[model samples]
Target: MSVLELVEADFRAPTLIASVENTKPPATVVDSAEQLVDQVIKAVGKNIVLGAPLAIGKPISFVNAMYQRAKADPTINLRIETGITLEKPVGKSKIERNFLEPFVAREFDGVPDIDYILDLRAGKVPSNITISEFFFKAGSFMNSPQQQNYTSTNYTHAVRDLLDKGVNVIAQLVAKRTVNDVTTYSLCSNSDLALDLIPEMDKLKAQGMPLAVVGEVNTNMPFMRNHAEVANTEFDFILDGNSKPDHKDYSLFAAPHGSISAEDHLIGLYACSLLKDGGTLQVGIGSLSSALTYSTLVRHQNNRMYNSMLSDLNIYNKFPVCKSVGDSGKFDEGLYGCSELMVDGFMHLYKAGILKREVFEDLTIQTLINKKAISTDVSLATIRALLEHGAINETLTTDDVTYLKRFGIFKPYIKLVDGNIIAQQETASANLSATDTLEWLEKHALGEKLIGGVVIHGAFFIGPKDFYDDLNNLTDDDHRKFCMTSVNYVNDLYDHMLGNQQIKQAQRKHARFVNSGMMVTLDGSVISDALENGQVVSGVGGQYNFVAQSHQMRDSRSIIKIRATTFRNGKLKSNILFNYGHNTIPRQLRDIVITEYGIADLRGKPDHVVYTELIKIADSRFQQQLLADAKAAGKVAKDYQIPKEYANNTPEAIQQFYKKYTDQGLFGPFPFGCSFTDQELKLGKALKTLKAKTATTSGKIKAIANALQGPKLDHNTEILLKRIGLNKPASFEEKITQKLLIAELTK
Candidate 1:
């Protein structure tokens, strides 16, 4: 929608006004975190059940102050409920620490540490302070003291869970903007739970329960418009970082991008192909998302290159699903994103003009657009469609006039009052059934087009610093296109507040919800969140929700991407196993699985067919063993033979095929851009290799001993050595580490 239309559409309905009047925010401002903490204690009491947003949207200083106050007074029982605690990496070994400490300080200079999370990591959280989360930062909290305090719930259910836990205080980070003495706030990085939680909290407060909805304002946060915007009155205690010293603005915690391997790139290509043009898209973080994003852009902007790669890989011939359900063609209609996490990928797509499929909030308009019965242009046909759909009556009411004006169906001067239609100079009958009245309205009242259409609807965002900057730099009009909303609205088709089932179905046509999984059993169960031991690798954040949602949305498909094989204890093993002890997605939910080698369409397939299809994409080295295991378990037919054409599903083969593009200066490690310096990148690769080679004690000693007698360091080696603080050996331990680095560099 045009930026101006967003303003025009802001006119609240009289019906909704009464319903939301009592639940509006207090809009009181506080000077500092300590002051806010004082207010919180007074409002909710010392037994503070604090609710915080996950990831970078957390207010670090405010949370720290709350924790410190609670710690200083054991009587104050503080329990923090949040997820994805982003802690700066601290290496385990001396050499690693030396390398990482300096690097971390440089990369994360202004990012404040979460004091309680740090203490929780050290197993030093006070007895009265309990920290818990429904999501983890992948493997971050596996061995932490609070690992047992995990909450297993879908993203859509977090608000319900938080309310049940009697969360009395909601401390959220927000972006503030003031215009002509009127100030407003944007949920910015996170609108996920708060959009659903705040109203419920207000209801509790109305019932005389002590509760506070606090906002910690940060100017560094991008002030996204549309759904993300909230009135200053919505927050009871706002620490305005813009004008307050105690709540001074700090740097956003940037989640740096990692290298996208060739395998991941291929997987992305396969997955994005299934993403139909003009459909809905949702993806998560990591190299796979980057790869998929890079390739999808290539497919849209440089179709020749993308098509050539697809043809060279013979994707259409081998994976029949790619031909039948997907296409190598460019996205002519673009896509709309509805994801829980708005990863940097969406930004890339948005910039490249691929994320431009606008969806509207009004069910009639959205359905008409979806059915191709009416376009965004509000012509005579749009009026006809609305009349036919019973969206408006022949005799216009005040509500009819408001609705028509809100959607820009009528010109600004056109108005309905006291039973008459005012059209500039001439008055007409309110009844559009009168031929002359309809003609006069169409000639002077109808507007040019629709407004308030948003291309992306996401719950939260976390990405590299560049992506954040781009978001902050967006023009007000462009910013409105990205609607940061609630997880329930973004991740489910069942949400009723935004629209009904028909409207949602129309908006999400041909949806492709792509997600990454760790493993897939031959029976088609997907293992993503944890291992066979039931240890939590990461929370099942929103993958399951989108996957399940795809089944309910029309013409939608759930594509699960997995690396064909992975290194477990330095041993290569097929990720597509015969069976797994745990599963996040059961066999019945299986649809499509993508790997570097191939795509496996598991939808509605029998056990034998599913087994063979999975085996077809498994690493060639383990295919025989996997097939045998499947046969032994009777999952596959005893007489089933591996297809000769698909027998060359090896990593080397995958690498060699991708080398064709990488050699041509395409498909680089960091497809979008690299965060690491050239020198840091070199050292990081060498360090990882050394760490792997020295996994055994004997191997480490032998390598160090060999390095002691090695030749002098070359100029490049010296430069890299200096980068990681090993240019000179200052101690006995440093001397040993220096030798190890020299050996790895030389090798």
Candidate 2:
């Protein structure tokens, strides 16, 4: 039997709400994905505009069932509008398949595939079904039709776009918690956009448009508190079988830490130097983010080593902007995380005691904290500042007492009635404006510390399995420090209705929004998400939003890190080009750019200054050509020559620098952790070499000839071959492949 058929008895679809419940109505529970899909179709009609969160929060079981139903019946027009539809990596060649398939199976055991993605990959997605994504998993869908339907909007604008696209249904994978017979759901990994989208959907429903919200409780998912926690009635329908026999419990998808190259470590070191203490931080995923996380830990946990490396590397003398814009001291005051994507690196930061700066939502408390007049611990000074800031009146009203008590500025035992402050109706102050009331308030009103303060305000979270475990293991107090909020709060300084603009500015002081770009032009513009000829390597997810936010904030700096050089199609190429056909971020928003060589301060600079500074941090091999191009374009002085210090900014120079610190036990390739073993690591390198050779005909021919001339393989070679199942060399092709692989592995 097919996996999707309902295991429970037949039941009719329940009526979905057309308006938001004034008081939450009980959700109708379902037993199977097929039954859920049937209810969704009945409630929302044939034209189902389904909205799902990006990444891990998607309920794939429901998604696949819906897609199958749509496929089976062409009359059902189903549109899956979301981002980052994660598909397991498929090998491009027979040899690559042998090298990677086993690893994929081991890593992604029991993970169900999205039926639409499988069909889309096979180029057989039915015309009735449309999959529109705002983002892709970076270079995962370069040439697919995903580029055509890519929603070109900022993260904050996703709700607006979804509304315009007529999204009538929202489905998510949620985590359920039970307390005293009461059950509630937490959005968990994806409170990001949905927190904002739900209110808009309610507005739509109020206008009599039919809509449904469905949730599938995934026991594997961690139940997050704060804004991610929602009442059970928020869902129109629910699927809450935690441990039924029919339920297929699969391993939650994991993003194992990738290998961070030596150059990437240097880039991270430079980038981390720009993050100030007690500031806000924003970082994305992958090796660079992991490198930054590792370096940040080094700065916090081992400041002596971090400082020594910086001074030895001549960072302050060479890139003085780091000292000016950021600092090289321990994060004694700590940092607050306000990011769109809460990657695994953030967990590393949190574990190292680096992510500890807590920001309160109360504008009065936050403003005072930002001004250094008060701390998270409420004091006499806090009351004084609140009075001075005109946030409160000397004559405390019942409203003022309630307001103060909400933030724990007032003790829990205290209450106000008829313009008098009382503690359990026994201790009373009749006149709050009197001089005696000041001392009375200080003695009775103050609490130990600020309540409801959060260290990390994230829109969504995606990481490895262990990362989730770390979250699940956090103490309730520690967990409360993290608030899984909406993109409006984390991604931008707009949304004044929520006091976001004013409060966020007070919270996010000296923010360093670190992101990655594929390339930067000589003029300082960056090409991050797309390639030339309009093929998007990835969608402009939240990079543009953060860049714009950086520009809007006085102290916040947008830091875009590039690897300086990339070996694409088996040839080394500069990521800092003279010009690029596409630009994700234009020159006007140009801020700080970092490469392995050094940091380039491009904010508020002339065109010549921007290009000149950028060239100094570029790879040495490409500097001359870039300089010549700038001269040809008249963007820089015609006679300007490369600086002697920067002229040696080659890969060999980086290697020497890397060697200097190797003995000091720093800059490991996989800084966080890795999925591969020692032998597998060696085999991974060999596979890369094989891939590079196989990229071009001439390269492949040369590789084959070198394999023919090379010495015969020994027992050591057999071990590597056996891992990829080429130990026996069953065919002529297999024999040639083994020889080629052996040549690379032994080298």
Worst 10 residues of 1 by lDDT: 13-22
Tens digit of per-residue lDDT, candidate 2, span 314-409 = 988888998898888889999999999888888888887889999977677887788789888887777778888887777777667766766678
Predictions in order: lDDT: 0.83, 0.83
Stretches of candidate 1 off by over 4 Å are 1-10, 13-25, 245-247, 418-420, 423-443, 697-711, 730-740
TM-scores for every predicted model: 0.94, 0.94
Clashing pairs in 1: 25-233, 25-234
Worst 10-residue lDDT window for candidate 2 reads 1-10
Give me candidate 1's TM-score against the actual structure: 0.94
Alpha carbon deviation, residue 672, candidate 2 (Å) = 1.6
Compute the lDDT for candidate 2.
0.83
